[model samples]
Target: MTVPHRLSRRTFVGGALLGASALTGCSTVSRSTDVAAINKPAELPVYRRWKGAEPDLPTVNPLVPDAYLRYPRTTERAYSRKPGDGSEVKGSVAINTPIPPPPDRNRYWQELNARTNLNLGLTITPHADHTDKFQTQVAGDALGDIWTIPDRTPYLPQLLEAKAQDLTPYLSGRAILKYPFLASIPTDSWRGCVFSGRIFALPVPRGALSALALLVRADLFRERGVDPEFSTVDELMSVARSMSDDRNNRWAFASVPTSILCTMMGISNDWAEHGGKLTYFKETEEWLEVLDISRRMVREKLAHPDGITSYNGKAWFQSGAVSMMQDTYSALAGLYQQAKGDFEIGLPIVPGPDGAPAKPWYLNPNNAITGVSRAAPERIEMLLDFLNWCSAPIGTDEYTFRKYGIEGIHHTVKDGDPRMTAVGNSETGLGDFPIQYLTESPKPLYLPGFPDGTKEMYRNLKAVTPGMKPGPVHGLYSPTSSKKGELLGKFIDDTTNDVLLGRAKVSAWPETVRRWRRRGGDAMRAEYEQALEVKAG
Candidate 1:
């Protein structure tokens, strides 16, 4: 089915309004660009001009606004009636599934559909295995109007380049800014969606404070009289050595492979600055010191003997065998819920060789940007409207009921906090309800069964976590990501992993850098440079 490329100006204008609504009330605005016009309320005359198919103006002014300029309404119409009843506004939408919904049945898709005003029929696809599925569908012209393409996949750049609707107009204005919680999304998350100054995706902003941290057993630390707050790597190692008793079926700290360790230590594979260059980790002594310390930790037996074999680091922490491991803060809630004893989980800011706290690794800001398919243009407005609604803060009672389910059915409020009880269970043994995944409001610090002081413990952990220095690859989004950059990405990942794991020595890093440059890295750099040039213009 060869889809016709209409290139209709109205479609482009309408899509622009929809995209703009998604970002309207978001918290962080990009200072890098001039978005003044987008920050204001929609002028009514402009709305009248762009309203559906009727041109009120005699001639289209290049600068004049249209009906598409109206404040975006919520798209919750789909949830107004039962699925397949067709009582709501009757537009069909294709979306990616299994779709995430509020745990409560009453407010789930019903709220989503009512806000978006569309019947969203989802096409089930896994994020990991969707590349070929997406390609085949797009090539066949069988794509849904709204689908989520994973940010991690290689196919995103290509999809955007192939005439996908540019969402820049929609995202730039007051329509999106009206929703207060929607305003909280960070601009960095939207950077990946911008190409040639046009936006194509609605970014799902991961919170700014995300970072990898060490999770340790509070029970074990208390028993051993260890303070659990080590000022230096040496102090941490000292505790690990004393606590590790692998012979008695205990290990002080579970060993993480080199790549994660290096990231925790802040060793980026490449660094760029001043719009001119790229540098490798081999050029820095800090990189070598991090590796040397890690190798010694393994040799000294402070880490698990089978550390290399223990790939599931979370499971190690969960089983109570490995007392300490590193992971993101998102894991904190689950780990606290699952651990048997009253244990505290703390995030020690990774320490440098000088025993001073080092900067935590900052992930690429665009980590969670999402794209909608071009197959269904009408669906775009609905999708963005629903997203904006979801980003709003819920009342405390509403938040608990929506996230945990009814008080007696799925959970019980104990001591003024909701506790997980009987209702549903999955293969993971815990119920499928996810209280922590809500992006609308900042997650509450309380959870049932955690020690009374756990909230304070988390506050203290965050207080100690170090700030991030700008990444070497900061502000660089690859435009050549269209060409051979996919191969280059794989090489970088593979070579970096090899060097970190000690499978390839530090001496091999320079050659690895050269190999990467030879295999499209240089070209990709050039592409980004060009993009920056255009953006500057």
Candidate 2:
């Protein structure tokens, strides 16, 4: 989904007025600091070349008018083929629907086609079996004119390189600038779609430092006389111990083995270098400190008893068997609705040992990039036209509401603001649907409903956490390093799991590090270094 970018005063003022007007009595103009003034724009030292080695856009003053914000009407652009033609200009798409089997092929296709002015040929596949199915389709050249590929598939780079077309020419200059919200998308996420100086894929943009926040039961905290805002791991552990109930088999916290612990420990799966020299995350005191803290969490029993196993922390938390846990923003939404009034959910920033706020390690890449297939060159104009339409605010709103729900029906406007109606104990079937892959649509921001405290909570969390920096390994994409890459991932996972489970002592971490080096970590580093040199040259 699209993220909010650093807004110019003019833009913000205009947007505020619009929001205020929409809400009748609500004051849209909230006091906000100039983001640019408070946070320096990150400097991307590495030069990135678009298709045809195009130069970068001129740096715009955050306060000045950006010409790109101006979007043209649909009729202004030339269509590749006239409407109603039987050629490849068909408005519909064939997508692999993410749902369980016993697929309703006819009704599914009919609903999609009837809903929009398009046709749909859906291939229903379970999310669990999606990767293999997607890979098979790609290998068999069975991909439709427009289709979605899963984000977690390891073959993503290959699919982009070999199957997807360079969409840079379609999105550059006027095309890219047409979407005002596009600026909110981080540059690093855009860079993820670039390969060998060509943009081949469109990404689903996410926040730079989006991470799971620890959702604590506020009433429990108040009763225990503990401050809701615990600033250090030690403080969190103390609360966990105090709140825990082993006799009743309730946990103070249910732990899920997420990369979060490793991320906090500064263990990045993606590492980079420049000019044959390893750059960031390879050796940092902060990284080591994070790891040490994680080890303690497990050893001290503050984490769940089944933390090592793949426990469903969300289920546990919702069932009142656990009082604290970490999860993504979406997870928080689900829990908030499920636990409404019974318990007050509060968000806390991940903290460092010194009890200061620290940014959690995150990998918010732009997923679901829209692109044309090379086999269909003539469809480029049509594809661009569709994308242009999708990028507009109206289109984004429609897509988002469809995915989430419509206001006042599935949701409602509360206190002159838009918010979802509680889905608690309902049979709405809203949660059963999977609407994201309905088409190759533009991404929208995952905003919490207005007038709700959730958005405010997110804002406060963001303010406290340290902002993210571009990883040293930002734009290093080379296929040759695939084998070593797999090995490195295994090495890290094994060592980290062992340490957390107490199978391996924390003191043996240095030995594990040495083993990683011995088992191709050094070679992988060298390969990345060489790739960086080539890019610089």
Candidate 3:
């Protein structure tokens, strides 16, 4: 898993807010974007005014994203015209995947620019360094016209009020019809983008209730005549021992499998609500149990020594150094890309804890949020138009070009599905320009040309969905969390890592939690609960 970047409290939000007091409260971080306003989830916009192609599969529950067996041929344009005013637009976003050529050199970018009649300059920062660069930009007041707010970026309300445009006038509720493509964005995703009870940003929608699973090298398991499924901890340990061969530098797994274990033990994603009261994972015994499991994995040498910090765990897994690993469901396609058919990857439903039923934890629907610079309020409509063009639904000309790129040049329609050619794979992978995460439409779950992988992933998700538990505070916000979350989180993370690696005693966990609560965790919970109460009314 990629380590999330930490937003420095002293520099990112606190400092910015302090320095921004001189600006008018209406547009700055004082009144319009106050803590109370920022923490409240916006009333969801009505899901009307969108007319687009339907999905091929069943999506009875809105939380479950529609799955696709193959890409459908588009019939109509989502928008009849472009939204640009023939001007230059600059955006800053992070990309950790395959790096694309510069905007000037990338053919796909050239085509998109020509189509929109705008010079869309994107400052694609390295993912690992994005937080630092974002902070530097904020400190220096060098923000671009459009920017992505990464999941863990601190003090979003302050940042928005001080720097980002209030999009309510252009996008609040039915006002979103000006960009039907954006209106097509799932309401749950839009709810997440709210600040101070107003729609402040364009969301990058992910599956609302997605979870991570333990993926195994099934080919290796089958070759070794080992059963991939285990009903108990001991059984799993036996399988781990069989898969590991330390003399040859191989290990049973790449990391401590605590995430899956947490789900199996019925742990909530972050908080659990009961009788309108909130409880955190840190306050539960299962959290300690997860720590025990991690420590045991290290003590038993079942995990790679560098598992926690290795930048290439997937490569290690592919090389057979480790046979089992954990990754998000959305990464199913990329895992196959890394394997290149060398091994058949399999996802086993995590067994229930101590023979009890399992409950998987879902990921937040969005990976990041994009905000328009407050400095360019006049250009809000144009910016929305650009995003709407990017968000053109699954079956439209804009979607086709954005998704597949010049059908013949980058991809070709085969059996009614767009397939990337060798040139496309070499020159234009989705990693080059991560528009999907930067500014996007709802993502359909499909892996083109890999029908078997797609089907297998669908089956896994279908099986896992029924047992999933949502994060209690998915769209709900907490001012305390936005301000002190990163700092308090570090305390918990450091303690967890130290205990798991045997550098500290597991008994030290309770005290760490105590410190966290004293510092800000309890306040965050209270704020969220209050927010939830207000929303309930």
Q: CA lDDT of each candidate?
A: 0.46, 0.45, 0.70
Write candidate 3's Cα lDDT for 105-221 as tens digits: 677778888888889887778788787777777777776788887655556665676677878878877788877777877766676677666777777766532456788888889
What is candidate 2's lDDT per residue for 218-315, written digit by digit as tens?
Answer: 66778777675665555666667787766677667676323344344444433434445783353455545555766666665666677555666777
lDDT computed for candidate 3? 0.70
Winner by TM-score: 3
Model 2 spans with C-alpha error above 4 angstroms: 1-116, 151-158, 178-184, 256-276, 279-292, 337-343, 353-356, 367-371, 375-378, 388-397, 404-452, 464-466, 478-481, 534-537
lDDT of 1 by residue, 12-65 (tens): 111111222232233333221222211112111011111222322222321111
Per-prediction TM-score, please? 0.68, 0.69, 0.88
Q: Give every collision pair in model 3.
A: 37-196, 38-196
Off by over 4 Å in 1: 1-120, 124-143, 161-164, 257-276, 305-310, 352-356, 365-367, 374-379, 394-402, 424-475, 479-509, 520-537
Name the lDDT value of residue 501 in candidate 2. 73
lDDT of 1: 0.46
What 10-residue stretch in candidate 1 is worst by lDDT?
1-10
Which residue pairs in model 2 clash with each other?
Answer: 1-444, 2-444, 2-445, 202-369, 203-369, 204-366, 204-367, 408-411
